[model samples]
Target: MMRRRTTLLASCTALALALGATACGGGGPVTAGGGDKALSGQTVTVAGVWSGSEQKNFQKVLEAFSEKTGAKTQFVSTGDNVSTVVGSKIEGGNAPDVVMVPQVGVLKQFAEKGWLKPLSKTTRQSVDANYANVWKTYGSVDGTLYGLYFKAAHKSTVWYSPDALAQAGVKPPTTYDQMLKAGHTVSDSGLAAFSVAGQDGWTLTDWFENIYLSQAGPEKYDALAAHRLKWTDVSVVRALTTLGKLFKDGQLIAGGQKEALNTDFPGSVEKVFGPEPEAGMVYEGDFVAGVAKDQFGRTIGQDANFFPFPAVDGGEAPVVSGGDAAVVLKDGKNQKAATRLLEYLATPEAAAVWAEAGGFLSPNKNLDLASYGDDVTRATAKSLVDAGDSVRFDMSDQAPAAFGGTKGAGEWKLLQDFLRDPSDPKATAAGLEAAAAKAYRG
Candidate 1:
């Protein structure tokens, strides 16, 4: 979907509001309580939307940093709506030393407001050596670097239940046309063809983006993300028209448009793997495997399989993705400690911790492929790297937060409407262009 789990931040003022208020957080430098390392009394606080098992797994990486640097670290799970929660923290003069921004849009927005801390010289050198220029590009705003993409997800994948596909007597579609044919065949076999999470407009947006990228190529995709190309452009029209082929047909979707609109991401996945499976396939990132495994207790490669989202324009498989970047604040409570954390994350060793945990991917090109959790993840990682420059970040996350991140607003609203009834591509285009224009005007 969008940046399924992402980050956000706000601006900060130099003045500390009171007579003698230090920058960012309330505490002084917090080093090891037992006084173990060279630096004493320094604890760096990290805030993000990560929690539960993801939080528990990430703790291992944090502990690794603590062991290596003797700098105590506390991770604050911000829960859902990171922008709202983290923005409040910053405004309240308690911004964490380092904040994770999930998408380039929020990272750039935070940097644009001068809230992020620039990477230290030592940390910079480590990231430079470990990551590719493309991954690095997402972390930098203009010419200054502020974030590091630590975790990544490959969005250009379609998950299918092999038994369902076989019963339908159709293989996964190799081409866009073949995809539609497979859908029809699956329907003919008395199964819904697609399980779309229409409740989350971003998933629908992703569908359009994948089709557009394959059909229009990367240049147009980038232009659109930068608003260099208007939503009213023929490229967008073509993509929407192509989307219409499936979305317009109610029988093709599980429970039709109404049910699709009500089905959330997890529910959409459940449609394929649940007891009374509703659909044969769902298009999502590799993370969905974790969803299947954890929620339904299904064996991924056995019960479910995936292929790169089939090419729509007779082009290569479209691979769109989302990733999390670690952006340190310039006025962080403990710059040294935060820098140490970033340095650890930049290394291949830390990546391997989460890698083996499954459902995690790193854009660090230096990391070995074997570090991935499973054969499926390895293949997905390879496809991601192989896509190379062909890869594009999720489009909505690149748009204004009001339009992209906010629920019941802008693209999310209009696209929900479009999916409800997609015959009128021109109207949908006009609505999209209008909302985008208003949001971008800010």
Candidate 2:
């Protein structure tokens, strides 16, 4: 089953209009405290998986918080293993005051361990006003609110270069079969149809998630995510089989599977959008637009544009997404200051900071659409907010860390192996089931 709610777009529109008018009067950066500087002399520490540009952009949000409340903020990068990093910090009695958890399963683990502090009533109220209920549900554990989601990813977009597509004489496909046919047609022009990032196993998981959600529908998708349905179920086999159609086709993938397996995530985007393009299209989240622009110097709406991932087997298209949640640690010394930062994070003001910097999407419905840096970014953010509770979170993020988040083991490795040799979807399904069983049971 899926979470259902009255669509949030109407309320979001009204709030945006109100906020927009106030924002136009003053051109200063918006802050949650209205420049009260009430938090001077307090220091709050935060940890998360963000690094490089993402880390830089988040720092700007913290800068705004400091400006508003005069609280000093410190950020630590936890890399990809957020649970392990945070757990070690807690054990050493030096835990950060707050952490931006990357997975819902990890957030629940923290809350269940009594390591997370229940959010303040003020923070909860802010969340209720600005976000759809589903986001709050994901941030809650056992119906107790503990976290606030700040960043979201639209995982169903397929990005392409307009020049390349026009030269190939093919429009974006609306169905799976049409996508494949168009891929072949593009290949016939001596260009690879798709640039796949096989080196990053997480990308493989996203690819499978979109196909699974669309072809099998949300019930099976949720079952498979929770491990209530085995990965070896026919649904998984079917999704894997469908994915193999693209993975196994060497001509359709740029530089063949071998090259794809060697290319990292950003490299895959560069292959398509770079000056001398290696492929015509790439499949990833809306973040691809950021990479295309910042790393490759391409324009968003002009040189880079995306279509919703096509329907699979004539099924309705699905919206699969991922987000990071901000939570407070119960044992932290700076509880007051940390809670203050979280309250700010729940506001449209904090969300707008990263949104204007590009490569960011906020679930806060009260955030003005004009806050987005570009039209493409605005459209993608609206679709994500519009999907509301109908959106399915990234499947791997819902599974235990040992199974879903690890690099060389579990789903990541299994999918990478599958990409290396995609001839047997049944065998891949079996491997996935075994790994999932061990992880879930543990």
Which 10-residue window in model 2 sums to the lowest lDDT? 1-10
lDDT of 1 by residue, 197-237 (tens): 99988788889888999999889999998888899999899
lDDT for each residue of candidate 2 in 309-336, tens digit (9 for 90 to 100)? 9999877798998999999998887999
Q: What is the C-alpha lDDT of each candidate?
A: 0.77, 0.87
> Which candidate wins on lDDT?
2
Question: How does candidate 1 fare on TM-score?
Answer: 0.89
> Can you give the TM-score per candidate against the true fold?
0.89, 0.93
Candidate with top TM-score is 2
Q: Model 2: how far is 78 from its true place, Å?
A: 1.1
